[model samples]
Target: MQSNRGTPLTPSQAASPHAAAVADSSVTRSASQQALILAGVCIAVLVLPLNFGGAAVSAPTIGTALRGSPVAINWILNAFMLSFGSSLMVAGALADLLGRKRVFAVGVALFAATSLGISAAPSLVWVDFLRALQGIAAALVLAGSSAALAQEFDGHGRARAFSMLGTTFGVGLALGPLLAGFLTQTFGWRSFFLADAAIGLTGFALGVPKLRESYDPHANGLDWPGAISFTAALTLFTFGLLQGPESGWSSPLIVALFVGAAVMAIAFVWIEGRVTRPMLDLSLFRYPRFVGVQVLPLATAFCYVTLLLVLPTRFIGIEGHTAIGAGLMMVSLSAPMLFVPLTAAHLTRWMSAGVISAIGLVIAAIGMLWFSGIGFDASATVLAIPLFVIGVGAGLPWGLMDGLSVSVVPKERAGMATGIFSTTRVAGEGMTLAVASAILAVLTRLRLADALPGSPDASAHAVTEAAQRVATGDLAHAAAFLPALGQPVLVHAYDGAFRVLLHMLVAITLASAIMVLGFLGRTPSPTSRDPASPTLS
Candidate 1:
């Protein structure tokens, strides 16, 4: 029997078979729509991180046209990373207080606009400024998108959602170089940014309307003091490391910057603890599982992100591979990410997320160590094997780490947890890039001093120019600036510096693996179905 609009009916009367079927169909449609909305979010994420890999491949050309110094060129990448990492927690907090959909829409619009600004930039300074703005835009999008997904899905569904996101991220990073190569080689580096702007606008048009708003009711207060301290600490810390190689490490200014960074870091912790609502939840770190999930991303970023930039640069500068060609070479590093993330759930059934991540790190360390042994004379075929192994290692832990991070947190705090995870990863990348560049610079100087015997001042000046050119990934061009006698030495020096850098990465990755294993405790045997916890399914 049909119920009148104002009348209540018993269960059997209320749910006739036809009515039940109709209700089920309606639910199916809603679920489909929700999945489509998640797809849009993934599309945006996939396109965003592309900027780094694409820019890394094309940076030499940009540096050459702009006549930028090595430091300025590195800053092109560092500036965006630094601002993104610093602003992530604040953006997350804002999303949880305001509206996620509103913040996300704003982020998409801002990203599109700033990308255009970057494309039209007249100098490195303009580019850096616009890139920094884009980073903030990206932070807003990341926090909003991930929080929305976490709220909508749970258990296996949430894991699937995160895996899809990770897969798209991998696809974007993998294809970025290829796109950058095609655009930059055909038109110019500016074309890459223009492409990004167009993609951002398109993503905004499709995504914003379908996204539902989600926020934490209890999450109040902006926590400006904590935000300021955190940002200042990372900025100052990165500044010191970046400057240390150029100016003496013990220089008064560098020392002061380091000291200021330390002070700000302590202040951030103090402010967060006392605040009514903290930007970072200090209590999350006390949970070993949460700590493990967070630390894995850092280790992944430290071990893998540098290779994304460094390898393309190496190929272009030393081997004279076209930008596109270098990007193709990176397929060995990016392609495995595609398959592994999609099947991460299957792997987790056999081992804990921590065990899988540690194993992946160990594999990556082996790949880096293998690459370290191959000198400049090695063929691309020789390089491909190690690069392939590294790609596999990186892929194994990709989505699993992201899922585990939020799985351990309450749904309400997903934005905050994601913010912390993204912050740690990018922050690690920024600091590691700075240190790696410093190592490259110092090594270049030492090598040049031995090779070019003359007035100390003259040799020092030559070393600086050569290092700048090398940093641009234009080694063949660098030869034009160096004396014929020193050209070989410069090439060999760049090679040696890269080897040492890889070794350093290997050491860091191994250390991270050990920590992960220690914190992970034990996993259920393959035959056992572990009971679902509130944090993890």
Candidate 2:
């Protein structure tokens, strides 16, 4: 039953050792029952983060109570993302080595405990530390859940399972803000962390009985060096990108950090090639379809994050919508996510993954183009259409690409493949935001220069400061200039930003389309089993 390439199962067979252990027992439930249980666990794990954004308004109050600086407040949020992103590969590798169910249970316990700590922390430093712990817990849950899903189902069942996972993720992203708002408005910001604790505990209780051990006993030992090097490289690179805008891009510290990151990355590649128990096998890119599938998520995530950053400011700052109203308007951006998984599953019955991905990219490109036309006077409803379209575009690719990537590989390597795919998606999103913001900054300065001529010192300084403020979305400072010059300068800067974002979307979409068409030729028949399956591999 071992697959040749490294996927655990063919998407049609069970890869869990527990499945075999229970195969002869008359006490086993039907496949549908097991799937439902697994899906419920996935949803429970995902709901932990749903209230994050809503807590944004309450962060200041929390910060004051904890005696933390504004910088500490930022860390409280960023710590989660950084830890979550950096620990993914490590979590996945551990799961493949130690068994998924055991590691997953451990993660759930840690997550619940850390959430409680975060909720009760008396100082900013404690809160930030707990948040990083919570993020590590999240990485464990996410990595284990994904690999387990791939192990438990194959073929159309696999498609449905992947769709369910995507749906769970989408729900989390959409509800996070709404839940945060309600909890913060009523019980205070601490309720958000409390909620995460509750959810994590619930998942642990359910998963203990239903989740089964899934791991290849033949898997290699942990590659600690590779893991450390990879984590350090990604962390340094992300830190440099995030700080470059604020610290001055040409600063010695920033330049040195990037250089260090580059060196670490090169060393990581070299180490992986020689290590017997590599954390990530660079050889996976040899499969053209696998490579193509990876690119779709990278491109999609890049555009998705950019849109999320750009749109709300356009609504509230330019159109004068209240914060709550702007948030409501942005709901359209996530609405399509609700239906995309089911839609993608149905479409996969007839369409190849490549075709589906290409179509999605085209839809996303069109949406980006539509968004570019938005101006200072645009109505909320007018913006919703493109936002919804963008959501639809983003929704389909996540599940489709994820399913395809795992499906193409052999079962034994499923964990590594999943980890790599996830890492690329996060890296793409971070890089996209940084790159797009940099471009917008440059364009805004040029426009500012053109608008404020005849006074070189004033014009140069004003343009530089304005560009920085806009990149950071400092509306107060941006509004200060509106009184001095007519609002035309601000409007032009916004327009330039939007235009550049649109072109980026188009270029990325086109690249994604080409990759899909040229590399992902067709969906292979769902017959081959993944060699990574515990029993088979």
Candidate 3:
């Protein structure tokens, strides 16, 4: 029988053979629907993080193979983040307006096609183009599929479903580094894309047909003007950050981009207020739970997600660890995600989820500080403890975020809620990743400005070039540019920049902990999953 919490049952319940077919057909049907969602989403969860963690590990190799510059190297990663992050809000709202099954199928199909194209691309330009395109597909998959999963489960079941989601994400991340290392070392980085295509298509084939169509009856057509303005704002701001260091922060072009981004952001907010059906409902931000949920992903973006890119490159490119070795080292960072999220979920019975999240952030802050103390001199064994600690802290909020996202809002608005929270998480990651790269480059340049032996103008240009290469883990190229002192000087300069980055992360994590606790600590936790429930209480 269907539970009192209203677990969705399949229409074709009579087809199920479980529980003697006649008895509790609803139970069998509910099982079937949950199985479909879990299968599809689990497949997607596996492949998506592979692209993230695997691709980061593959970056230095890709740069060397493609003969890419520092700008080119960073863009390969940021292009995906920018396009994927900025598009999520619209994708979520789109799912609510259109059919969730339709959006999801299109996303997975597009993913397979793009992965194929990326694998065959001969240049960084083509690769970057495809990666950005892939982000759009990723946005669709995340929004459509996650919302579908949210629709099928409720109460304890809903919590469990999302916990599984977090755990699957962890599995992918944990495995991504090692898998990327092996593929890049043996078959080449391009093979990783080949793997993505195969796994994604298999998931598509298995899961799409099982998912039923869903749409919010109350949703009007998408607010196109708001969508466009929001995307433009995000794209412009990210581009400005990426271009600032190289173009001169005050360059007319960079300055214009920042100004345009600010104008567009304001326009988006204005348009949302006036629209009868806004793409992003501005009214949702009034609720503290809504704001608190958003902060969870944003914090993870800084403390955990950025490291997925930063550390892989640092280990393989500068520290001289093999791709496989770096992968093994990263397992410490990725493993907690596998188990800690469930532990966090179970803990909610005794403690407020908000308090749990706050404690986790504190732990992550401590890990970041411990991590920063180590230099290139440290071994993988020495690095493991800190990496594991960081992962443990991040996993707590990761476990609860998806479940809380749906519980805080009306059931009909799951898609929009998913989008807003995801957009903040990803857009923040992309923009922060861009900003962090630029800041590191600038800091590295300043450190080397006086050390180079050339005349003022020549030295200025050399330092700038050297810093770019150093920031991307291209030490050989950087050494070539600065012949006076070689690799040691480059390594020393990078360490200084990295230290500053760690300090920023620690400070931000601590503040985020405080912000989230204040916003959500008093809010009641959801005890029973109500299909139509809006607030946790």
Q: Among these predicted structures, which one has the highest TM-score?
A: 3
Q: What are the models' TM-scores?
A: 0.86, 0.79, 0.89
lDDT of each prediction vs. the true structure? 0.69, 0.62, 0.76
- Show where candidate 2 strays beyond 4 Å: 1-40, 48-79, 113-131, 147-163, 181-191, 209-216, 309-323, 407-415, 437-469, 477-495, 521-537
- TM-score (C-alpha, index-matched) for candidate 3: 0.89
- lDDT (Cα, tens digit) per residue for candidate 3, span 29-84: 46776777677767864677778788888888888788887888898889888888
Q: Give candidate 3's whole-model lDDT.
A: 0.76
Sorted by lDDT, highest first, which candidate order results?
3, 1, 2
Highest lDDT against the true fold, candidate: 3
Which ranges of candidate 3 are over 4 A from the true structure? 1-37, 150-163, 217-220, 406-415, 453-455, 526-537
Ten-residue segment with the worst summed lDDT in candidate 1?
14-23
Model 2: weakest 10-residue lDDT segment is 528-537
lDDT by residue for model 1 (1-537), tens: 111111111111110111100011122326787677777777666557688688788777777677676677778877878887787777766665675676678888888899898888889878878878987887777766655555455456765776576566767777888888889888988999899888877777666777666544444457799889999999999888777666667889999999999999999999988976676767768767678776677787767877887777788777677877787887778777667654654777767777887888999999999988987777778888999898778666664665566556554444345456666777777777777777777776666566665636755666666765675565655566676545566778788777877888899899988988877635322111111111100
